[model samples]
Target chain A: MPKHILRLIILFVIVIGLFLVARQFLIPESFGEYGHYRANSIEENANHDIKYVDRAECAECHDDIAALKQGGPHKNINCQTCHGPGNLHIEDPTPENIVKETEREFCGRCHNKNAARAKLIKQIDINEHNIESKCIECHNPHEPWN
Target chain B: MELNKKNKKTRRDFLKLSSAIAGSVAFYSMFKPIESVANRKTDVTEREHWYGFGFDIEKCIGCGLCAKACKIENDVPREPFFFRTWVEQYTIKNGHIIKDENVIVESPNGGIDGFTQSVPDKEIFKSFFVPKTCNHCYKAPCVQVCPVGATFETPDGVVLVDDSYCVGCGYCIQACPYGARYLHPEKKTADKCTFCYHRLKKGLAPACVDVCPTGARMYGDLDDKEGPLVQFIKNHTCRVLKPHLNTKPKLFYNALNEEVR
Candidate 1:
């Protein structure tokens, strides 16, 4: 009824109208497509090239080594775990790219005596346990401690 | 008398106008956040993935390869304190009365390098490495407490943070019971392990899973009943960390030590 009241009502209506118009543009296209998030995120995450190749791929070529590793202490260990990522090597086999791990320090990374390690786990002090010989000389990584 | 009547009419109009403006302001303020809720986007999809993590305590040799791999993969700071994932070595002695014996828990440099024995050989009774990461709880406190919708759980059951959206309020960091989250030093946003969400989506095992010399850590789809993770969970006596909190952590630990928190 009042002039000022009419103006206020008109202003409020305008604000609401603007909000309704803007909201459509503000929200993402894929929002709420999957749960409460953007659906395209799935496709985005899947875009990266995989770096690590699993054991199944290694078994394709190295069946002998795979057979030796199975049922052994190191059965659970993947070939790439020690040899390093094989995606490049799988594409092109090369001694320079995919070589057997020969360094004693590589083995020492896990087997070296450490107080934090479980007591039952066989650990070498190196100084006390065959310091003269390399780990692979006495222990075959495929069937270690055999 | 006529002029006074006109003045009264103007005053009434002014009161009504002021009230209307006040009402509009209040209404706008109330609905603004709700509208933002509709706009708020999480970097997640409705994909059917039931991601789960399994840790083998007995298998862990405290070699820290998992931590190292996780750090390198996630670009976590190489510093000891800023760990996206870490391994804690727990050593306990004294059999029956465990409290009577010495119990030591140490994770030097987040166990990035293999740990050196702190206690002597004979003195120690039992020790094992517990690999730690974001539990990605079904009912995550971090998701609940985030001021913004920055941190959220994906349909695959992976909990992740949208660094772009995070306000760096640190609520998620504090809410995480497992201490999985930290305010990233440079990014200033809450950062935690996404179970290598990027890696998972790419059809590869997580970096930690790939690098673990011993099969101490495992990740797989929980929905796949025939999968190794489901089989492992079914076969083994598995326990999650801090079950009492009721976070419903997806990370299952086999042979979890009593001393481990």
Candidate 2:
């Protein structure tokens, strides 16, 4: 109701707006690039949890898996998808192992969906695209992406 | 100007001084010509050296192994953009040079795979595997047209991008007629076949050459006369990927019958 109070409220709003606007400019681009932004991610319990692992570390003892990677469509797929958590595997190197799937169907967690572009991998095809068999039917999981 | 008689030195003395200066200069230069050292080993000879690739068109099956192997080796960026290498399976089917594009494939379905084709033994097709790689042209248009000097030809003749230098102008993208280059999204650089220089330097074969069930994709030093490529050149007549671009593509396709062009 008073002009002085109205001016003070407008100034408060501007300060809040500036803080929000400058958030991106202050934050590093790579800050959130790697992880799942959703609230349900595995690491959400921690105050600061950013988890990721490049594939080479997985190939260490999983030479069979690595060799299989050489033979599969998932050769290019980042191993973290089906391998579950990676930082723990890197630290322990033994207990958190790859939960191998029955067939090539295991490779489809991220690949199963159509992406931003028209689907490069129609992994959903066995059910949706009308392909006769699962992924391995025409593919060799150890040597797939070409 | 005032004329000088006694103030000037004798012409004979000046000639003697000039001759002595000229003789010393000649003697000093004769002993050292540019101070060249023993020939240094080139980066091309090092692990980064570029090896030229050529193909035998007659033997190509259109199996798409070259395209596929590149995707595996590089983890090619996906979709609406077929990458790296693709097979142009040419055939005289239905009385036409039926060109089939067996490009890079991501396989939930195994649609298209590589630059070399791997037709099954039981199947019937008038096709062969013609493996393709970056042509590594001497005067690569991709290199010359880059607005940011991102794409550059190496001393070894392989045209490469200094991804750091790339501004994502996409000029090199348009300049390439062969469709050899693409804009890498994460890095925002122009990416293309490096001819697997990293492996070649280790004395290992390119991934496609390694995976080819048939020994279709081969790499060797084109400059070396004793190299397998020169030996093959001497033994058989082959064709370069595109002669008209005048890029002088090192990749050669062999065994192309006149019928399949």
Candidate 3:
């Protein structure tokens, strides 16, 4: 072979070698193990701390309130939906940690009259629906219809 | 010169023979039946689990508890614009479902604050609330458009984003037809629902489904033939969002209004 051809072959090999070495460093170890993404990411995405506890967890301790809620219109509603996340309260069992929303505005979030709301949901004009007293005073949140 | 000519002819003949063999091999392989990516079976363990989601529009009361639960569960931004899930109220006037002007859609605070009537009762021909989230499509456009391989579909049929790998390109955000993806303001990476993958792994339902007071939402493994999700799909005439796009979305809706897009 000519000297120039030998030099070109050496240069080509060096370029290919550099690319192979670079790929080892640049590409992630787990890439293409499952698909195109990093395999470890699946575990990472699945490892977040569960902020919302199941209703069964609340029922474990508050069986009385759970029993009251069971027969109500809001039977299907999770306790944490209104009280906020109960994970912290589950650990401490403190009344201060869990919210006790009694304000009309809090009730108005769902109960206030809205045309977009489904006809099945009980809605009322917050202004005219017994304005003087809180919702819990007249309508028991546990069994509102009763 | 005689020897040189013979050597050249032999080399040319070898090249031709090798080329013919290569061509024949390529031609044979082309005709051979190969399993497509869609039909390819995953591992037995992975095949045993395939998640699906559905909701009943008739049952949804626009309570917004699902929206609130998702935000708190995922630690999504509190701003009205940012949402992993949201509820949209569609109001149609004069029963003109086809006309764009006849329909009015609103989702104030992503319907975390309960919806109020916008269209008058007299003009309103029909109206309903639609809770929207990532569909986790089988052929997801977001996964296809991601400049980096940060977004991918798992073997068990859940689409997920690798936060650490994302380059914050926003390509996937724009590509998603359902408007499910959003750029995380703090992380600068594209973020969306994971179908609550963490909770699902722990055998818990997605946060939105967990908080649905009216039992509007349903979720279960499709691999379980007796699962509620599969049963719901079997019993109800379910429809997906933008079926023409061919995303093959896993999210199904029953009693979905034709006006809803």
Candidate number with greatest DockQ: 3
lDDT of 1 by residue, B15-75 (tens): 9999999999999999999977675543335346689999988888887777876775567
**Local distance difference test scores for all models:** 0.80, 0.55, 0.87
Q: List per-candidate RMSD values in Å.
A: 5.6, 18.1, 2.9
**DockQ-based class of model 1:** acceptable
Candidate that beats the other on TM-score, 2 or 3, i.e. the better one:
3
Where model 2 places Cα greater than 4 Å from the true spot, the runs are A1-146, B1-50, B96-111, B114-129, B257-261
- Sorting all predicted structures by DockQ, with the top scorer first, yields 3, 1, 2
Candidate 2 lDDT over residue span B1-261, tens digit each: 245666577999899999999999999787655432223224344533345775655443344545555665566665636577765543223223444442212222122332212333233234433344577787778877776455665546556665545679899889887778888878887888776555544455555555443345667777777888777766778777567778877776677444322
Worst lDDT 10-window in candidate 1 chain B: B39-48
User: What's the lDDT for residue A80 in model 1?
Assistant: 68
Model 3 per-residue lDDT tens digits across residues B209-251: 9888788998988778788988998999999999999999999
DockQ score for model 3: 0.67
Ranking by TM-score: 3, 1, 2
Candidate 3: pairs in clash: none
Which candidate has the top score in TM-score?
A: 3
TM-score of chain A, model 2? 0.40
